[model samples]
Target: MNGDWLLRGRDGRLTVYLKSDDAVLCRAELAPGGPWEPFRRIGGDLGLQQGPAAVGQGDDGYAHLVSWRQAGTGESRLVHSTHFRPLLAPLDWSPVGHPNGRGDRTGTPAVAVDDRRRAYVFVRNAGGGVSLLVQKERGGWYPWRDLKGSSIQDQLAAASRESGLVEVYAATPERILHWRQEEPGRTPTRDETADVAARPGTLRALRTSAERTTLFFTDQGGELCAWRPGGKPVPLLQAAGPGPVAAVRCEIDGHDCTVLAQRSASGRVAFAAYPTEQEQAGAWWTESGPPLPPAAEIALAVDAHGTLVAATLDPTDATLRVTRRKAEAGLALEGWREV
Candidate 1:
């Protein structure tokens, strides 16, 4: 599942972007916790490949979206479009030439928009190493640069911290490899000190604080774990399903807390809340709604009112099913509704 399928805008409006057979479609909330607008095609008319898609929103409220279109042989040509401001509408998409030449076979890409409004797109190169393409100051893109990683999984993550520096998290069978800029507007270097192990396709990185990013992943024991750059892996939940977990740090009961939306072992959407980085203090998890199929993923976001919003694309009908936690009602969830 893509991390950005469901995300709230800077103005408190939530937008969901999904990949269909031929194009990418999106729906924007008319207002925060309000009615959603009708789905509109946003990927131009490019022939998109059958793959996962990603979306990154800048501090300016602009969104940078990326998807793959079939290229020569088995490779894919990367195509991108920007939704200027918070409108969540794009006129067309332009081709961002692949790093390994004409889409020479790459993994799923992740996008992170820095404080300067530049978009950093990360992907696994043809040789299983990570490479990234950066958006220049104006509008053009710089050539792809390899980040020196190996055996990296296709499921990876990239996030921008409050300091404006961007950090990328990827997993190999052996350990977790990371790339973080020493400061804003600099090239990210591999930080081998991040010693952690994660199962393939289950690693996620998000900035839960102004200067720190926490990683969520399933360990060899199948338990969900959280880790930071200089800390040990902290077990957070048990029997977590495969794929990435959608998490956000927000307030609950006037306390700073981290909320998690995960697919549980029973194939249901499970949510948990605990004090930020305080696993030893205990956390609570609850499952709700129907047991979803393995292919579907739950998207989580916190609205302007600090309410948690979770949604999943129904694999059967391709419709979006959403639920949100009642404001200040602990972890209580509202009934699921079809959108």
Candidate 2:
């Protein structure tokens, strides 16, 4: 599955990422509700595979991407690249060596920028535990540290609070393992387990408030569930599908709401909105735009005008297809258009 492709910068322009046959491609919107510039290759590496795990910062006007490319020795080398934000050209990628060093087996990588403007990358190691590498604010990396959590699976979710504190989560066989910084600009000491069961590829974490986050995932029964740290797991909707779920916190019709999008079982992109952190309030899914490819991932964000935007790969081609709502049309969407 692809990593995050749609990102919004501090200045409000949208950056989109796509995977080509050999390289990772990116493009940006000319304006909030305008046409996008042509796609360009981010790096010269032909060994790059899959979409990148993308992170955009409002603090710094830059987009950060982490992905793995094959080395001459058949090792999975992890690399990171940054873009000059508000829609500028890409820069040279800085090499972030693999977590395992030898690059044996690494899971999907998760990335987030801390409040101090530093970036952290997390991935599942070969031992079924998590390892991390932290980049300093001015561009230097600390030694790779092994974050112990046995029997961990993929789909590790991570987010940094406004305070510059970071949290990393991994799904184990029977529960969720969480590691968080004790304070801003500090490395997390250890792992704390949350007795929550989530499907392997369906975990997503987004900030519900200034420095707090809520995790969303499907249960074994395929029902939507939400859990905030130090709180009980709240079962949301029944059978919200087992596909990748996209979420963002934004204001809708004068109310601060949390919005979620997922590809329904019938292949259409559908979404629902509810009060942020209030999953018990009940929410309904509304199908929007058109049906996407069965395996396509939806990228959702709020634009500069507070307008909600959703993007996905075209059902038949390499182009990006995007859909947004009308001026005052709630979730009712305008038609799908290409980048």
Q: Considering every candidate listed, which one attains the maximal TM-score? A: 1
Q: Write the per-residue lDDT of candidate 1 for residues 1-339, one digit (tens) a residue.
A: 355577777788888877877788878888887888888888556778877887877767677888788777867788888876445568587889886876454788889899999999998888899999999989899888989888888877888888878988898877888788887778899885455667777877778788888888888888888888877788877745776788888777888888888878788888888888787877666888888888787787777776778898864457788888775558788899887
Q: lDDT of each model, Cα atoms only?
A: 0.80, 0.75
Q: Write the per-residue lDDT of candidate 2 for residues 71-164, one digit (tens) a residue.
A: 7666777778777674766766667888878764378888877877777888888888899888877777998889887888877887776676
Q: Each prediction's Cα RMSD?
A: 1.8, 2.1
Question: How do the predictions measure up, each by TM-score?
Answer: 0.94, 0.93
Name the top lDDT candidate: 1
In candidate 1, stretches whose alpha carbon ends up further than 4 angstroms from where it belongs are 85-88, 193-195
TM-score of candidate 1 to 2 decimals? 0.94
Q: List clashing residue pairs in candidate 2.
A: 115-164
Estimate the lDDT of model 2.
0.75
Evaluate residue 334 in candidate 2 and report its C-alpha lDDT on the 0 to 100 scale.
84
Off by over 4 Å in 2: 1-4, 50-58
